[model samples]
Each structure stands twice: as structure tokens, then as C-alpha cells.
Target: DFPPLLISLGDLRRGFVFHEVKQVLITDEDIFKRYRERRQRWVGEEEKKIERWTELRGGDYVVHIDHGIGKFSGIKTLKLQGRKCDYFQVNYKGTDRLYIPLDQLDRLHKYMGDSDHPPPIYSLEGGQWRLTKRRVRKAARDLASSLLRLYSIRKVIPGYHFSLDTDWQLEFEASFPYQETPDQLRATHEVKQDMENPSPMDRLVCGDAGYGKTEVAMRAAFKVVMDNKQVAMLVPTTILAEQHHRTFRERIAAYPIRIEMLSRFQGLKEQKDIVTSLKNGGVDIVIGTHRLIQKDIEFKDLGLVIIDEEQRFGVIQKKKLRELRSSVDVLTLSATPIPRSLYMSLMGVRSMSMIVTPPKERLNVETQVAEYNEE
Candidate 1:
């Protein structure tokens, strides 16, 4: 094989004659390795830029670690103690201003709360910020203690260990229309492993909208059904529950599993019959909105509970979910998880799997904002 040839664009443009031609035997693999390393470094730098909260604009709300929330006026240069320095000007409630030194930027953070409802600016003289911070710290402590207690209880309680995959499970997976992505495969495997273990499975599967998170849940639900246990899928809205019901029925049409949907859209008698069927173990899978968690609804032998868009549920619904977590396996799916769920996953308090790879035919969604015009 001939070695690769190198030519400089500057040399070619200058109309210079080359004294000699040299060739080096560098493989394509080496060039690709260097390219990958540089790409990774660039990606890391971009992530760091995103993580930093230094891009503050005027009139934006900001929160200080020492003080409470305030409105960022602008940056100003002032002389203090016989020295000139730049400080951030923040306006609090009622004509109050606090100047923060540039060196102490770490204490400033951009407010990340709901934009529709802006937070009230705190007055520095009232000392109310201190009291608010104290209450927040106490709430955090209580949450941490409760989480620890739940973890300890789950560790000791005996949970059902599912058997290995059967022939029917393999066939069901093979029937999927599209090829599975690597991340999807890994997440499915981890979920199955968790179910097979003695501990009650509490795995969070996070993926983008079209990353096949539903497929992972389907596999888990099928596994539970194969073991002669029922599955309950909870969604936030009735529309989503109906959509999931259709998808699940279409996917498992070849199997003998009975899937039912419970939503407000159904007639009162229809809903009552579905509830009755669920209690008698006639339904293998039930998909519904918050109605499924009502006091009257009961399952024969629930093995797994799948929660979709968990952030949309209210506190009471989530409390009911927590109660279910103590007994049945819970699989949570979220495109954008809430801070609490993300925190638990990061701290290893709960098993988490991320499917970051998008499917082949998925397209990027273009978002546009337009002024409303009544016609």
C-alpha cells in the first residue's frame, strides 16, 4: 500500500517548486482518535458554559445566597475604601438597593422558578429572608429524613423475584417494528434485572419524547403479566391515558393479555364495569388517569406500576404513588424529570436509566411563538 501524501495550501498558492515529496504512513484510526478527543474537549467546554450562571441581563430576577430574591438593575463601577471596583446593583422591594462585589459572584444565581408568577422581592431590612431560609432548610431536612427512612424500609422488605425471560417474551420483543437503539436496549436490560432481584424495583427511565421509553415500559409490563401479575399504568391527563391505551392494545394484539382503559371520557356504567373487571383479575393491564388511584378502585394482584410524566401529578397523587412504591415495582418515565426525581437518581437513592439516543426516523420539532389574533 502507498503511504498518504501531504500538500500545504500555502505552498500551492505561492507558486513555489517543491524540492522533494515526503509521505507518512499514518493510519485513519489515529486521525479519528485525535478528532474524537478534540470533539469531547469541545463538548465539555460547552457544557461548562451552560452550567455557569454568569449571563445576567438587566431587569431579570436574581436570588442571592445571603439575601432573598431581588431584581438585577445593572453593573456599576464605584470606589470603596479608597479603591475602585465593579459591583452588581440589585434592587429590592421599596427603594432598597444592595451592591454585590464582582468577586462574590458565586452568591448570585438566576431565578429558575415559574415565569408566569414572579417571586416577590424581599426587603433587606425586614430580616424576613432569614426566616424564609430557615423554613426551607427545615423542609429539606424533613424530606431527607423521610427519604432515608423509605430507603431503609425497602432494603429490608422482601420483594417478589421475577423469573428469567420466557420464549413468549422473546417473541414479543422481536415483534417490535423498528430496531432498538443501544441506550434503549441497555435500559431495558437494567429494568429487567431490577425486576428479577428481590428488592422492589423503583427505576426511573428518562428519555426524550421519541426515545422509545414506552417500549421499555411495555417490556416490563409484559414480564409482569407473564408472571401472572397485573400491571397499572398511570398518566396525568385523560387524553394521554387514551393514547397509551390504544398504543398498548395495538402492540399486544397478538397476545392474549386483556388491556383496559379507565378515564372520565368513558360512560359511568362502562367505568364501573372496568373497575369491576380490574378487581376480579380479568384485566391484565389497566391504563388510566388519576381516577385509577381512587379509593374504590382495587387490583387483584398488582406487580408493577408505571408512571408517565410524573412531574404533572399533584402532591396527593404522588403521595398515593409513594404508598404503591412500598409494595409494588414502580417504573417512572419522564422526558423532563422534576428536581426531586433528578436528585434521587443522582444520589443513588433510586435506580435510574437514561436513554439519550433518539430513534432513526425522529425529526426535530420546530417551536414558534405567534401573537394571538381573534378572527
Candidate 2:
């Protein structure tokens, strides 16, 4: 739960599902009064200010005061008046730009995609986005406050009733074709171990693009589905979702499993049917992009959630993903290779698996780099 705070504290602390916080008898009047006062949460102008450490960092989104929606590219240190200050460089579309001083970060938002379309670009020269920044900031602050309260209550609640059983392990292994790669075997073992543990799993399987990461997820999903439970596989793109749907359908077809794909590209009726099947337990495996996170879709018995290429998801979707991690088994697949130094820093604390070896008996492709010549 503490580690999840690094991702999103609100997600880790959201309201309880089946349990509620138990109230304690007040023993001291002053302490009780102080607690009661703290309970009346409201975002004032001072409260709306984001702390220096809590400001958006690189990889977070920032709504430009002038230009509509631009990402927080990063902060650079600058020497000014014999002192150092940080400037946030925002990449606005079509040649517009905004440079926000570090101290003014309170005026910006850690862009959570509030609307379907990218927030329209306000005229930069007219300073429209800047004018609306305060209102946006206030809204974000209110959301944060609400999130904080919700999480506080959720932290005190107990977990779910349905627990994972181990009957599917045998069937899962039997369904595999082509001997498992050593790395794949290791990852499967890690996943199985996580499933058996009481503490929820938040493991990442980092592998090369074609290094059988999906196969590992398949093994886990098979286990969950075999337990008569539903599984959700969240991809980052529509193309990837379609590809996964085909791959999963082909792989799980050997067993008595029904897999479905959900996305905007599909017909409205088809999506509705698929969603209905998901809610009624007719669909065992669901594969889609972040569209799966929408409120309309509900799983009958979601035991596991497999997220592929999670780094590609937007911040808001990722936030919801974190919310799902508390009690559900979350197996993430990352194609981006982490540097050894950075991995070392996070090694023991975060559970991770790396697939470095190619499959045995597989021939390595011969490659050569030649200078590009325009002919």
C-alpha cells in the first residue's frame, strides 16, 4: 500500500468495498474536536496551492496557461541573477509555447484527462489558457481533496470475499505449446507464486517486444479463467487490443474458454453484447485498450487484470489501474527495457522479471548496419 502511494495515494486509499471504517470512542475532548474539524474538508485558496514537492514532474501532463493541452516535457535548471531556478518547458502544438516558473506550478494541473477531446488550445497571444488556469487549478485541488477523503476511508476497509484458488495451475501448464523459454518459465513461476500469496500481486514482466511476454500473461489468465473467474487484459492501443484478441482466442480456444474483445472500433451492438456477457460471466477473458476501464463495463468475477505495455497508458487511466491493484492480481507487461542502474535502484523493493534469453533452437537473425545512401 505504501509503494502504491508512489503511484497514486488516492488509488491505494480509496473507499472500502465491503467493509467500513470503525469509529472509536472519543477519550479526549480537544483531540475529538480537532479530528472533527479536520473532517470538514474544503479547498480554500491556500489549500488549493500545490506543494513544491507535489508539483507535476516530467512525464506528467500540464495544461498550458496559453496553449490548450501540452505535456510537462521536463524541468531544466537555469542560472539567473547569480541564483538557480527551474523552468518547466511545455510543448504546445503549432509553434505556440509556455514557460512556467517552478514557483508558479500551483497554477498548473497534473493533467488528468478531464474531457474526451484534448482541451482546445486557447489563443496564446490573447492569454486565454492563462486566464482559465486558476479555475482549472481549483477544480484539480477539489478533486484531490475528494480523492484524499475517499482514500482515507478506503484505507480502513477490509478486502473482498472471493479469494483465488489453485486448481487451475495444472490445466494452465498443460495448455502450453513449444517448451517454455527459461525466462518464460521463470516469469510463470514468479506469477504463480504471486497468485498463491495472500498479499495482492503488483508484478511487472519486462521483456523485449517479441519476447513472449504475452505468452506469460496467457498462462496466468488461463489459470484465472480456469478457476471459473473472469480476466481483464488491458492493452495500450486498438491495434494491440485486436492483435491480443486474436492471439488469446487462438491460444485459449484449446480449452473451454470464451474470450472477447471490446473497443470503439467494434459496432455499438457488438460492444454492448460483449459487455453484457462480461457482466453475466459468459465471457472468461476480455482484451481491450483502456476502454475496459470505463464505468459501463463490469466483470462478473474478475480475478486477474493483465496490463500490457502499461507505460503507454495516459496518467488518468493509469491512475484507475492503480486503484484496481489493491485486491486484484495485477500482472503488467513492459516492453521498454529498464537501464541496469535504475533497475538496481528498484531491484529488491519492486517485483520485476526480465526475459533476456531467446527461445532455444531459435536461430538468431543476422543483422548489418549500412550507411544510408540516397540513390
Please provide TM-scores, in order, for all candidate models, with all chains considered together. Answer: 0.77, 0.55
In model 2, the number of clashes is 3
Model 2: residues with Cα > 4 Å off, grouped in runs: 1-172, 337-349, 361-375
Per-residue lDDT of 55-84 in model 2, one digit per residue for the tens? Answer: 656655565333556766677787766777
lDDT of 2 at 358: 73
User: How far off is residue 194 in model 2, in Å?
Assistant: 0.8
Error of 2 at 90 (Å): 18
The local distance difference test score of model 2 is 0.70
TM accuracy, model 1: 0.77
Off by over 4 Å in 1: 1-54, 75-87, 101-103, 365-375
- Scanning candidate 2 in windows of ten residues, the lowest lDDT window is 4-13
On a 0 to 100 scale, what is the lDDT of residue 125 in model 2?
65
List, residue by residue over 1-375, the lDDT tens digit for candidate 1. 433555332101112333464434344444455444433433332111213335888899988766889999888988766778888899999999999876666567778779999999999887899799779779879778877777788889978899999999999999999999999999999999999999999999999998999999999999999999999999999999989999999999999999999987899999999999899999999999999999999999999999999999998898788778887899999999988998889989888999999989889877899999898
Candidate of highest TM-score: 1
